[model samples]
Target: MTEGAVPLISARGISKSFAGVEVLRDVDLDLMRGEIHALLGENGAGKSTFAKILAGVHRPTRGSLALNGQPVEIADPRAAQKLGITLIHQEPISFPDLSVAENLVLGRAEDGWWSSVPWSEMTREARKYMDLLGVRIDVTKPMRGLSIADQQMVEIARALVSDSRLIIMDEPTAPLTPKEVETLFGIARRLRDEGRTIIFISHRLEEVRAICDRVTIFRDGNKISTETIDKVSDADIIRLMIGRPLKEYMHKLNTSIGEVALEVQGLTLPGVFNDISFSVRRGEIVGLGGLVGAGRTDVARAIFGVAPAESGTVKVHGKAV
Candidate 1:
């Protein structure tokens, strides 16, 4: 690895357990400057757990971490930030009621409380990163009103402001559309070009090929292998991640229709899902799926009347449910 002759961060002899059940066994990981290392693994693979240790969210039951080859005790997240490390969560992270500027500088406001939030300086810094991310939104707006994609961009912007050397992005594109994904990849490229190290975690294999330089696989909580993207295929990654070959991703199709089990129309929640419409047949399951905060549960609740709906209609078994 041209850039990784010396890793910015190296972890060795790392082991973690929960309730006496071993999750990670002396797993090793390294991130070099200006490199995007993708971490792949199936559910329960301990991928997130390892990332948390680096972010100071969890301390490994047994392990040693060296930042720039110097041992450091990551006592808390603030310590991680002090070492120029940050983690962009798999889900959107933000303060709903806080303005974009406030959220960006909440923890480390300017040195002095006297005009601690210099409006111009805050906007300048926030805009610099938002522009770098190619995302345009009102910086003064409260985060509660922004979409998930926009919120994620703000999170990255926050990391940049903190002078982060290592940015760990967990499922960064999980909620984005194709175009939004492209924008994220572009931001990642820009970060690498600026000599930053990133640990890119995503479930999608193609995204790994598209943006990552090196790939690391975790299966059953152990580091399987690390290699350049050019040397591996999606099939190979899946095999290592799942401990079995993924025959194909497009293997499921339906040629028959079942009876109607559910029918919902005019389902309404004033501040949530409004007048949503859908139908499901008997012995049928309709997966109400979408990005978080996309009204998936809101729709379900309206149908179930878990909360009183503002207005709407629902039909289950030919009767209003």
Candidate 2:
């Protein structure tokens, strides 16, 4: 961003509440043009709330917004879209029955209710944007059958089709493969080169460092710091996020595993998961590690009888549960 130039989006004293409970306090941020700005925060840190406010999902309880030095009120999502802003959620909210091309153009003004459907044009446009992102998918395919990564690509293509000046991506790479994430980063860089600003909300520090120019850290409903990415190391960013030194927050102690406290044998959840077996000792903390939708949560739920496995034997202290 050039010195003394007006920001593309200026947020001042932004605050939000829900049902009398405050979730975001007074915060100010300035988003520059043609830059990938990262919003870093843990869960419930008000970063999402701030992004939603910019996307028109939530209104600030006490604040003012300015676009290019002009005051504006984002009444809703449509209003935000009109101002060249769009938010792509963590989970791609798309119509399962709709074709990929139709979903891409859904809610777009050009696809008017009174006009005849333009299947060929929409498919061509969708294909063009997907190609720009280096993704090749059948635009005629139903959205229900697409993978999470592909669906996210479609959402990004839609943003491009809308000519959104400022796009907010919320955890976009969570469900993506490493190769898919690479493609996304390339597309983001291309968009930035084209003078479109992006607000990337992510938990991964490495990703923020790789693709972002500047980062804003949020904690406990407040903005902690905003600095050039090169100026802050991973430890520095982590310290700011947790409000402490990294060593203090993470302390590892050697310990011996005791006798088995719980055991699972041949746990199965139909097509979801099969033949999952594990044992947890009394003094062990086993992490179910994997990416999103990797059945980690399902395994925990099944072991606790929240969602009983279709076929499995669980024993607690050598007794069947």
Candidate 3:
């Protein structure tokens, strides 16, 4: 940020509570105009809560918010949209049965109650924004079977339709392939160059360093630090986020081995997961670690019967389930 440049959005002494449990306390943040500011924190941190307040999904329990140096009351999602603020959720929200064009202009429709929707005009306008994002898709197709990447593009186009100035993207790259992530990054940079402010939330540290200009760290519902991305190393950010050194968290544990408590044999979900076998013994702690979309959740789901395996045997306490 330039010296003395006023913030586009300023959060002062903000706090939030749910059912008498405080989630955020006296948090202060400033988002500069036309910059991609990354919000970093572990699970259960107040990062999402703070972003909700900005997007009008939740109101602050205390403190105030200012836009362009003027105080504003963001009552709801509609109010946020009217204020040129839009939030694209981690899971893209759209009407599954509706066509892409209809989903794009659904909420911000210009026609009156009795006025007929001009499909030709709406499709033309929707195509314009999609083109701006360099995405090509059939606007007449239902949104149900579209890929996650395509769904995300539709959400971005919705923001453009509303003439949004500030867009908050919550874990936008979680479900995307590596190539799709690069494409999304390019679109984000283009948005920034066009003078739009973006609040980027992600757990991927490398992605943060690759695309964001500044970052804010959150821990236990408190604002820890905000710094330029280039000035802070990845290890420093991880320490701040977890409140400990990485080595300390990675220290090995010493324990006695015991009889097997759970076992899996020949678990297969075809393309999802195949030939997986593992066992967990009593008095032993085991971890299933993998990158996103690596079928970790699928394996768990199969074990739990959420999705049954085609060929597998799960034994619990020496008895097959």
Candidate 4:
């Protein structure tokens, strides 16, 4: 193929299984020169498994993959990286105690302890990666000290440092706010402008609409359709993901009224929800949504005392009963 003339990667009849369960069956995928391709699927639709196989986290049970129209072998993550493939996992990989600069340069500066790396240059390189993604964080700060958003930024830097040809992002925006998600989209667009291909896997339909040029739907580990984003609607993608039409995902909202149910006053759960006051009465429902480990479950358990509440006040009606 000519320079950036063909799709950067393509797969034909790729199949994979774990233990005895077949997850991907003859899936076909194509990644163009510099486009964001969104992969859509339901909770257990084998989307992650297919992305992992492409990332070299797992070898396929059968079929073939080609890079720039050339058949190639992908046995492991290192092998994939060697072939210019990198994965930014849904859950970022980082050492909590490590400094941002240290984590970013670990792969490069670890040459058997004989080679010396100029600290300033390494830090500069790390900074460039962060800058490319419009991320601002202290290189000297430990990863554990950063918010989920910041940590995710660091993860994106890792991909940039890998000289990634195709960056596979799995649920990247799940923990991000609307603004943070926008920052990520900006970075993705920047990468595409620089001739890097991205394969984005997300359940957020809005995200797919915003960042993807092409969308691919996978159901039961098989590729259903791949089409230009302009040619398909979110509803269309959802239909293929769950093998259903519109009636399932789009349900009308309804509400009923009743008496006071759950009330917590001056609720204090150490390191979790504190000074939290919320109520859900009979026939009422409450939503508990936050980052993956933002202590949502902890707060719920503390309210129920299934887990201990450091300090809190609970009331059954207007009185503390």
Candidate 5:
């Protein structure tokens, strides 16, 4: 951002509290025009809370917001949309049963009180936005069956349809494959080139360094520092986020392995997962590691009964669940 130029959006003295527990306190941030600004912090660092305030999902307990140098009150999500702001959630927030085209223009439909739904026009417009993002999908299909990457693309298309100047993308790459992540980054760069500001929130530091111009680190509801990405190293950023050197937290511990506490036998969920078997001892801390769409989360979900496996036996301390 240029030294003398006014910010595109200015948040001053922002503070938020939920049930008397403060989540953010006297926070300040400036988002410049035509730049992808990254917001980085650990979980419960109040990053999302700050973004939600900007998106009108939550009002600040005390603060002020200025868009284009004028004070404004964003009372709700609809008002935020009217102000040319949009939030693309980590999980696509759209009607599961609605068609892709319908979800793309869900809230900003143009149908009047007596006018008929222009399905053809809607489809065409949605296709145009999808094409701009280089995403090819059948716009007539329901959103329930679409891949996470495809759903994220649809959310970006919705932002384009709404003519949003500032788009807040919260963990947009969390569930996307590497190829999909690169594709999404390309689209984000295109949006930046077209003079749109983006608030990119992510845990992946490498992605932030690759795409963002500036980064703001938050810690325990406080703004730690805001620096140009090029001026900071990864270690520097990590220290700022966690308040300690990385080496201090890298040492591993040894523990005695006890009897099996969690055992899964022949866990299968058809195409989702196949014959997954694992056992964790009472004193063991097992990590489930996988790439996006690798069915790791699916296996966890099935074991937890959120989505029961078609054929599996989950035993907790020797008793089947």
Candidate 6:
């Protein structure tokens, strides 16, 4: 940030509570223009609460927010949009049945209710923004058929069309593939270069280090520290986020492996999974690993009979279940 220049978004003494339980407390932050600012914290650390306050999803219990040094109140999401603030959620929110162009202009006031719909103009505008993000998709297609990555691109395109200056992205990469993440990062960098400020809320330290200019860590409803990305090490960020050194949380335990306690053979869930076989022995731990939509949860659901497998055999302690 240049010396003496006003921060794009300045938050002071911000606090928030839900049902009388405080989630954020007396937090202060300054977001610079054209900078990708990363917010890092563990779950319930108040980072998300702060982002919501900025996005107008929630109001601060006590505090003040300023845009370019001018005080302002974001009463709701609509107000935030009017102020060029938009929140891109982890799951892109769109009407599944609606066309991409329709979703892009869903809540905008340009197309009055009494006026006839401007389908051609809407499609052209949607294409313009999508093109800016370098995403190519049929604007007339229903959002239901698009991938999560594509849905996110549409959401971002919507933001761009709204002329949002301060975009808060909440876990945008959680459901995306590595390739998708890179594409999103490229778009974010391009936006930042264009003088838009971005608030990147994520737990991914490596991603933050890769793309962010500055980082702020939160722990137990308080702001821990804000530093230039290059000035802080990953270990330092982790320590601040968890309020302890990484080693303190590392636990190692040894247990003798017993007979198989639960076993599954040839678990098949039709289109979901096929020939999934695994066993858990007593006194042992196991983990199912996969990317998003990898059927790990579906396999567990099938084994538990929540959604019974189409073809599978389950045994408990050598007896078929």
TM-score per candidate, chains pooled: 0.88, 0.92, 0.89, 0.85, 0.92, 0.93
* Residue 165 in candidate 4, Cα distance off native in Å: 0.8
Q: Per-residue CA lDDT of candidate 4, range 68-113, in tens?
A: 8899999998888778888887678888998898888764432432
Clashes of 5: 0
Estimate every model's Cα lDDT from 0 to 1. 0.83, 0.90, 0.90, 0.82, 0.90, 0.91
Q: Model 6: what TM-score?
A: 0.93
Query: Per-candidate RMSD vs. true structure?
Result: 2.9, 2.1, 2.8, 3.5, 2.3, 2.0
Q: List candidate 3 segments past 4 Å from native.
A: 110-115, 256-260, 266-299, 306-311
- Summarize candidate 3's per-residue lDDT along 170-281 as a digit string, tens digits: 9999888899899999999999988889999999999999999999999999999999999999999999999999988787778788999999999999999999999999
Q: Per-residue CA lDDT of candidate 5, range 83-159, in tens?
A: 88999998888899989988887647533411355889878877898888887988989999898888888988888
| Segments of candidate 4 deviating more than 4 angstroms | 1-5, 109-115, 248-266, 277-285, 301-307, 313-321
Pairing residues by index, what is the TM-score of model 4?
A: 0.85
Candidate 6 structure quality by residue, lDDT tens digits, 1-321: 698789999999999988999989899999999999999899999998899999999999999999989999999999999899999999889999989988887646544631355788888877887888999999999999899899999999888878899999999999888999999999999999999999999988889999999999999999999999999899999988887899998888876899999999999988999999989999988999876678999998888889999898999999987
Candidate 2's C-alpha lDDT?
A: 0.90
Q: How many clashes does the backbone of model 2 have?
A: 0
Task: Give the winner by lDDT: 4 or 6.
Answer: 6
